[model samples]
Target: MYRSLLLGLAGNSAAEALALRYGMRLGASRFVAGTTLGEALAAVKALNGKGIAVTLDHLGEGIRHLDEADGYMGAYLSLLQAMNREAVNGNVSLKPTQMGLALDPVSALDRIRAIVREAELHSLFVRLDMENSPYTTATIELVRQLHREGFSRVGTVIQAYLYRSAVDVKRLTVERINLRLVKGAYKESSSIAFAKRDDVDSNFKRLIKIRLDSGVYTGIATHDETIIDWTRSYAHRRSIPRSAYEFQMLYGIRTPLQESLAREGYTVRCYVPYGERWYPYFVRRLAERPANAAFVLRNMGRRE
Candidate 1:
């Protein structure tokens, strides 16, 4: 119930505005790295030193203007350059809406194509983040287009909650594109998404197996220990190399688990999100785990 409520609030514009006003004081600092690129890069460097790879995300979405989209693209380009210069072991993940997919898809595609090419120059990968159902088809299609255009380093995510995901995974497998599987965080409709944890988990495991067997590099992005252990076991039984797939978790949510997996010789990537506009992303993180929410509640009365 609490998770559902927090997920619902993730889309509340008023709540987002209020939360932004309070900024880091809202206890977002625990989840969000910081509000600047430098802070985020520092965090990335620390993770890199610890043998953990990183996927840098500049957190803002639901863009409305071409200028806003252009800025995001520029920011990503700069980020990619910085990573190369700093020798950080990381790539990037971005939302299509943040690139103006809703306002003008052609523009968004152009922006993403440019970023993908830039990443190519830097020898990095780009992952297109899947938003809610409204953007699912578009996100998948965009990745397909990129692949056809020879941007093989490009990839995207699939949320297990959506019923269409199984099919989407198969279709994407044909393209031979890399993918990240996530248990979705969006507030989705019962008609379209699984409503129970058991259903989601079951589907998640199914998707993981499908992707693993598909013979592509897959990212299993889950904090659930059961899923993590199962993935480890499944890969071992199949004699899959550690390079065949990697484990991913959010930046601050499960530090110890991430490190342990890395120590165990698993390729682990941390989703490091940083930017001033972190309200929506932070709230979604809260919705994913009750313990994170409780931590925030305990510190609510205290100043950031």
Candidate 2:
């Protein structure tokens, strides 16, 4: 119930405005990296020092203008430059709409191709983040397009909640592409997505096993202990090398587990999102876990 409410409000302009005006003051910093690139880089460096790899995301989505998308492209270019210069141990993940998919798919493709080219130059990887259902097909096409063009460092995500994901995974596996398997966050409809948590979890585990067995580099993106243990046990039983797959978690969602995984000789990457347009992203994070809602609300009331 809370997840649906929060997701609805993610698209509410008035709610976004109010939240953006007060989110930092209301303790959003705990989840968000920071508003500036430098701050985010600092966080990246700190995490790297702890033996954790990173995938940086400069957050903004639902863009509608060409110039706005161009600006985000510039931001990513600058971010890539910084990552190379500062020796930051991380790559990047980006949203298609932030590159102008909503305005024009051709223009969006051109922009993303440029970014992928830049990543290739820097020997960095780019993960095209999966958004809500509307862009799912387009995102997959973008990944395939990049791959066909010889940009091997590019990849995309798959959401387990979607009914079509099993087929999608099977199709993608044929290409031997890198994939991040997530349980999904957006509030999708019952017609297209599994309405029950157990169903989603089951699909997620199944997808992970398929991807792992196929010899593709799979990112097991989850914070669930049961899933984590299952992944570890399955990989161990099958004699899969630790380098064959990695575990991923959001930046602030599971720090201890991330560190523990790293210490245990597993490659763990933290999805670190940073930028001023953090209201929507932060809200979704809260909705993904109800306990986050209570913690944030209690802190907000205490501050009051």
Candidate 3:
């Protein structure tokens, strides 16, 4: 129900206006560091200087124009070069739909190849942001093809909510695919995904255990304390080192926890998103934890 409502509003002009108004005030503190590359660079630099790694995301999804996504790919390549020069322990994250996959997968893949080539120059990595079910197959295919082309620096995300995530994990393991596993953020159908949080978390633990066993450099992306603690304990019992994999969390969702984890000898990467098309991302974040929206509204008047 909530997912349907959000997908419905994703195209609403008026809802976008309202979201923008609320977002402009709340985004600063909630998650988005800025709408520009320079601002993102500063944010990543500050975090990396403190020994905290980062994953910089050029936030805009469900793109309609091939030209727009082409431009997005170019921007990401540029950012990759900057992060290399800045030595910011960071990489770029991207959405296929935002990269012309919605317009044309061929063009999107071509553009992604260019971006990945640029990343290769800097020895930086790219995390292909997974979207809703509609694009999951194409996203996986793109990542697999890129890996085949020797772009090992690129990775993709898998959502535990999906029934096929375990299958995907197994396939990725067979192919030596690096993955970042997240508890599905988008509301999905019970037929296709775990509807309850507990079910999803249970699936998450299973996947984490499998990834750890595979010795693949999987990213455990979650803010749930239980998942984190379980990962820590399982790693310990299995004799998995902290450096074997990494921890990733969305920016602003768990700021202190990210830093704390980094300080505790874990590789922590903050998912820093930026760009003008932050409406859907912002709205979903609100829906995930209504308290976040309330907190944003309650403190919209404060200075950063």
Candidate 3: how large is its RMSD? Answer: 2.0
TM accuracy, model 3: 0.95
User: If ranked by TM-score, best first, what sequence of candidates would result?
Assistant: 2, 1, 3
What are the Cα lDDT values of the candidates?
Answer: 0.92, 0.92, 0.85
Clashes of each: 0, 0, 0
Among all candidates shown, the one with the greatest TM-score? 2
Ten residues in sequence with the least summed lDDT for candidate 3: 21-30
Clash list (residue pairs), candidate 3: none
User: For every model shown, what is its TM-score relative to the native structure?
Assistant: 0.97, 0.98, 0.95
TM-score of 1: 0.97
lDDT of 1 by residue, 236-297 (tens): 89888888899999988889999998998899999999998798899888888889888887
In the predicted model 2, the residue pairs found to clash are none
What's the C-alpha lDDT at position 126 in model 1?
96
